[model samples]
Target: MMMMNKPNWRLLATAAVVSAALTACGGDDGNDGNSGEDGRPGGEPATSVSTLNLKVTDASFSNGLPVFTLLATNEDDEAVVGLQGLKVNVAQLLPAGHQVVGDPTKWQFAGDDSRNGAAEIVDQKNGYYTVTFTSLDKAQLDPNFTRRLNIVSPAGTLIDGTTEVPNGQASFDYNAAGAAADYTRNIVATDSCAACHGEGNGIHHGSYVEPETCATCHDGLKAEGGRTNRSFAVLVHDVHKVAAAEDADGHIQYPTELSSCNVCHETSAPAEELAITEWGNWSAVPSKENCASCHADNNHIMEQADSSRCASCHTAEGTGVVKGTIDAHLGEWNDAAEVISQWGSDVEMAYFADTDTTTVTVSITDANGQKLAADQVLPQIKRIEVLTNLGPNYPVLSYGAGSHLDAVSNGELANNTTIVDGSFVLPITGLPYGAEGTDADTAFSFVGLAACSKGNAIVACADVADPDNTDNYTGMKANMAFVTKSGFTPSKRHTDSLEFSKCEGCHNDNWQIHKGYHSGFVMTEQVAHDEEGKVIGLDGCVTCHTPDGTYAFNNNGAWEQKLHVVHGDKNIINDCTQCHTSFNLNAFAKKGPINTGAGANPYADGLYGTPITATCASCHSYPSAIDHMTGGTFGNGVYDVDKADAQLAVSAENCFVCHAPDVADHSNVKF
Candidate 1:
């Protein structure tokens, strides 16, 4: 790939932080100015002899009795002479999902004058108290249970002054979920989500959902991408991670914006429709009462979300929860050793089915008779195949060529060997070919791979024979193409299909037309467009089609379609038999190509090369007009943001594909 400009990591980091500030604390709607402790604007009950301030130094949920260190000071700033008679109490705000199903646990004090649920202060030094709470039984704690802490005095007096010293708040948000709090939301089951997040939809965080079903977004569904960007475990941690930067009150002073929770979630009094909104979806901004509903514990503030919450709900036996088995599997991959090896290639053999082509094929397998698949491998494996130099100058030759090679489907090449099989293929003239086998520059190449499945296409059974012994067997790995070294440069003047422009450079220009821009370019050339002057591309419709790929801009905002079906629909117009035409991007994104007839294209285009305006009119009327302007709300429901957002999850761009450059409205461009 041609080098353009290096990414400014600092700017990106700043932007991420800025985006996060938009949703920290919901507005305190319930905690209006008049509702203070004791139900007054301020101060304790009238005629109080002396005021007592109880603060917790160390309070954690280790064994129900949250260990706490306390400190008390009189109004005069003097150590009360009697110092031995102050009373104390500890309270906890039971989080949602963890309801009190039995006799609630009662508090009992440890000092001589202390009564059950009451305690006497002994010294002026930091006072320490451990309040033992009834541990949540398996029945009470939902695998996604979240709760908060509430500190109180022995006589049931609220510890209003007890805020964390560093941040000055005693309460903090705590989640039973893993490291992250539920951050992102999924919309698979709800028409609201399917309306926007399903297929042909793009609104929330890049629209990353999986399974394309209710489980994709609903906590009650399959529960995979239920919270925090879809992964419940990861979501819990990220939610509290905001504490690492934002303050306890949820203010982002440096970024010039108030902490606004509505930035991502949309909460309001939920409606009765199937498109109902939850406590999390109140408005573009949620009020503080909505937040305090869950984040009652001030301690969870400014600290990372506790992953221990995950263990609370997703234990040994729970559906839609991360089981212990999943954790163990992830750990195994985390601990695996990185392996390194060198191999050779054959140049004279056939790389692609067609001769004189710069391609190669290889397959990997495990000792098992069963084929290895994507789901079986740990996600961390970065296979490295080193290529040794049989010649000298070839090193420079290979390096110069590798930079120009872009495998449209796979990410960066991670291996160093060329022609992955033990053989190699030298180059021919008239093509971007070079002698790779001379020096490090020529002989080496690198190709990167993510964990896919465990079974090989040919492997029938595990070599271990016994299921328990499967871990002891070694698995096989192979590369699919000829890799050239990074050092290779163009031998003569060369130009890119986009004339030296990066994919992002041209793609971003027409971000709306392509639907999913600046992301992956799947082979969705045959995808369909709506019959209403909308821009439909493969990125939005490939959810069900690719199965493996995620999305941001979906096509119909209703049902997620597959590639073959989408492409076939575009070509058929009126005939049904046209579905068999040779469009392949959707399938290719999921499964690698076979040879030529019924498989993937080893080499795929980075852009949508062929124009299919004919298909554009199927859903959109021809001679697109400025419906929102000249006709006063004349365009499809897409051109208007509020209207589009109010409609079933379709984006304004979906209507812009054929409207602009063909119609007279620039207002959509303003959006």
Candidate 2:
């Protein structure tokens, strides 16, 4: 159950008409109105209930009837009443099968998500409720058998009763004796999905957050659309495997390689308790239903193995060299995984004076950290380019050919030849930024290339493949380096912060998303094994996607907006914690709006969105969602912008009023 340590907000919201104190929430770049004396927005206290936590404490099944008892409480541990519109379902926790990817013991579903009509609900109106499911087949069920009760309630009907909307689930298991038994179906945790989809922000329009809750009803296949039945394996595999898997418009592009199975079936996190159980079931316990979900497009192979084929060729006994599901997908082929790690970048841009030029040194080194000789790996360098941007912060106002140096300006520079001394010094001659701002950094991103080395010999990744490793021929991942305006001290910029390892957790260190241009990464550090043991600090991508114009990298404008828009379309982005280091709303509120590529920056000339709304719109870009955003009913704010109104707008939405800053708040659902 959740507790509302927060102050009451309705009183404060009622105090003002200008306040957008509705239930809807927007994203980052919040231009906060007033840090009120009471430490809340607009000097308000949040006493009104925002979200309710339901606990299914006890469950019992006797003969043909099953009963589930629950207690509902608001965030402050206060008893919550009046929560109606319950969609309850009971299912037996079945054993895993081999023919299909479903549990056979599950029986409560009568199609659709809810089992309706035959429930006797007894609400004491004091947080307790006894729900008995009638009309259950006596011979099919057992009171002593392990069973699960899934209580799903709609977001409203007041929970003293409710003030905000949070579609959630309260599921518990029990035997006839009211004791815990063998109900161990915890294969993947909610955080696994939350790591990408944001917790409680996806599936059934965000109604069900827990995977176990989903499995209770979804274990068996049911016909949906025109094609096959909708099972957990079928729906999930289709949504993630291909571009048009779920979308009719075919706009969704799977972010990582389709073969990257371990992205979801991850075995370990940074800690042991965080580790998942039975993760290897994806391969070990194969099923025909699981294989056909994604390989429906591969007609020939599917037809050949049509008879309950659990990809038996790749199973324990018969497959060729590759063994299981994990062995089927290709691994990273980044040609320079080693050399790039050893190299270092030294950038010098003297910017106290406007006319001063900058110099950059690339100290290419061998695996031993010594300088590389001309005869060494240097010949393997097929391609290399340096990218620069005015940083220390993001929404880069200037860079490239056509710069949008708006309200924020540091200095000016152009592409010019430079002279600096090192084993290999490449320089850009430009006037330094005038701002002597301490730690004001200039971002420099590098993209280098080398053939996959065969032992110590430099060989083209394609040619040297005793096995075909041509995917490595393109570009090499490189580290991002930043330097202070003093051009002497190194620094780091404040961009969209995320754990580099977290990204690697899915994409792996060899990910070069840009392909020909290189995806730009190789894990130099591991959060699971570090000295200080930090899990954050991986800021990149904004350097090329700045407003200064890198059309190749930017379309929806700023990195903040683009990241959400791009990923949101593919899978899920509403869960901010998936990529964000933390929800530092105070810092986010002070940030600026995103430029939707106006003035020859080529994104849809002169279109802009307010920071929070723009980022929210990145994913919630439907007409209905926008109406909720522009305050059609909630509150008012001019979020959408045109070239005429080029100025960035301040935060005006009331998203935070509903989405309190904490781990438990439904709006900011961070796992």
Query: Which has the greatest lDDT?
Result: 2
Off by over 4 Å in 1: 1-98, 101-612, 615-671
Looking at candidate 1, what is the lDDT of residue 211? 18
Candidate 2 lDDT by residue in tens digits, 1-671: 11001111331222121122111111111223235322112323234445666655455555446665665656554556666776776665445542344322332343222233366887766555678766642124455466666777767655345465456466555555544444444455565665556656646645777676677667543332111246676677776776434234322245555665545654332323333444445665555556677787666546654334444456633366655454453223322344344443222323333634444444445555566643343335433345555553543434353221111001111133222332334454442343454333453443333344453245543344331233434334443445555655544444334555456644555444554333233434521222233321234455556533355424574666666666765655555566666555654454455664434444445456555666666666777766776673452333546633423235455555555544233265223
Q: Per-residue lDDT for 587 in model 2?
A: 48
Q: What is the C-alpha RMSD of each candidate to the true structure, in Å?
A: 22.8, 12.6
Per-residue alpha-carbon lDDT of candidate 1 for residues 1-671, written as tens digits (9 for 90 to 100)? 11112232322332233223212222111212223432112323222214443333233344333333333333332221222323332222223222222211111111111332322233423223334443322123233333333333322222333321111112222333211224222211222222212221222332222212212221221222112122331232233334224344432212111122211222222233212222222222222222233354645422424332433443333345444422222223322111101111111213232443433222223333233333232222222222221111112222112232322112113223233332222332223333453223222222222221123221212322432222322112222222333334311100111111121221211111111111111111111122231222222222122211122112221111222233333231222211212222122111111111111221221111001111222233223532422132332332222221323322222333334331222222423
10 residues in a row with least lDDT, candidate 1:
605-614
Q: What is the alpha-carbon lDDT of model 1 when measured against the actual structure?
A: 0.25
Q: Residue 640 lDDT in model 1?
A: 21
